[model samples]
Target: MKFAAFSGVLIDHSIQEALQLTKKLGFDGIEIAAREPHLSAATSAPRVKEIRTVADGLGLDIPVIAGYMGGFSTASDKESEQAFSEFQRMLEMSETLGASMIRVGSGGPNAFLAEDYHYAKAAFWLRKCAAEARKHDKRIVLEIHNVSLVETVESGLRLLDLVGEDNVGLIHDAGNMYITDTDYGRDSVIALGRKMFHVHVKDEKRVAEAGSPGTFVNRTKHGEEKFLQCRLGEGEADHQPLFDALKETGYDGWVTLECHAPFPAYERLEHDFRKVKQMLGLA
Candidate 1:
């Protein structure tokens, strides 16, 4: 699998700068954060053309755009319509960015677990979006995250079933799975199989005393442990098994480097990039 740098991690840098550094660091591609302070829906047409030209010139692929269209779990009818309108614009942006997939989160408040959550409403919107994406020749991916509807493999599968769109898929984010399911990540990736259209790479250290009253803590089956974001190979997660599993599935795609370590942007990204190369034996 090829490795890419996620622009969100480079919050301190402009998109142009982020692209330059990603190429300099030996990443095969870049994942743009299609959100605030980066490139919102209101981003100008000229700016979109600029990013596309720069990425192409750098020989960098934008594999996916991490969009802000969280599912309509709790949005009002008007809000859902608004979100759909916004997604259409994002699809246009993603097309120009040369992204094959558009990443969508489970909208609304973060759920500690997948149970007792009414995902039908979310499914409705996902189905609509997935259908729309197909028309654009794009795929929609939902991240397996802590606060979202698809926190576990079972839950994620169920949601996909509900959406029932062929182009709809999941993003196996190992760090987020650890926080929500205490999963080492290999098993989940194996379970996802071809349904996993994309991935976000991160290694989170378990923090025993992270936040008060489980604000940021997940009452995982193991226990309530806070997951502290850290650079790859510098945290509790062992990515070798995860890498092995991805290859086993014949997944030859981009795995974006995304972490929330408190280190400087370039330092953390470079560190994770090297770690991924080492684990994959690319170095």
Candidate 2:
């Protein structure tokens, strides 16, 4: 598997700068954040080509363009259409960026206990996105994130079945899984099997305090629980087992590092890179 750095960590810098930093930190590729100050649907085609050229020159592969397309499951008919239109633009940008895949999400509002209608809506929109991505010879991967329709391996598999497209896949994010379902190890990875097209490497530990929360804690309206992002070995997310399981599945895809810690971007990147390399026996 190839190691990548998500540009979201370097949101303060331009995409070109993020690429340069990623290469300097010994990453094999970059997962471009499809957001402002980096890349977006509104970015000019010429600029997109320029970024692609820069990445190629630096020997950085643009494996995936990460985007946020939440709320489609709960959106109205008009809203769903608008969301699909926006994602089509994102697929076009992904092509221009020379990315092999685009990251999407299952609809939100934390529909972990919603009815089947909500899931059907999410599946419809995701299948539409997958179709658009397939036309561009790119894959659309849904991240296994919390507060989404698919947070666990079982739910993710169900969504994939619902989408029913060969181009659709999942991104196994251990940190998010750890937050939601703490059993994100070999079993989960094996469950995903070939459906996992990419991986997001992050580590989080739940804070037990009553009032104070750490900088990395992700607090939401659901509760005051804290999932503090920290160094790979320092957190509760045991990624080595997950890596082992992925290896067993022969998943030769991008394993992108997502730094949510409150530290310098370079520091977090370098630290995660070293740790992941060690885990993969490259160190």
Question: Top TM-score: which candidate number?
Answer: 2
Candidate 1 lDDT over residue span 98-128, tens digit each? 8899887666344544444458888888888
Off by over 4 Å in 1: 108-117, 211-224
Give the per-residue lDDT of model 2 (tens digit) for 84-157.
Answer: 88788888887777788888767764546657887888898888788777778999888988777777788888
| TM-scores, each model vs. reference | 0.92, 0.94
lDDT of 2: 0.83
Candidate lDDT scores, in order, read 0.81, 0.83
Q: Let me know the TM-score candidate 1 reaches against the reference structure.
A: 0.92
Candidate 2 local lDDT, residue 67: 85
TM-score (C-alpha) between model 2 and the true structure:
0.94
RMSD per prediction, one decimal? Answer: 2.7, 2.1
Q: Model 1, poorest ten-residue lDDT window? A: 108-117
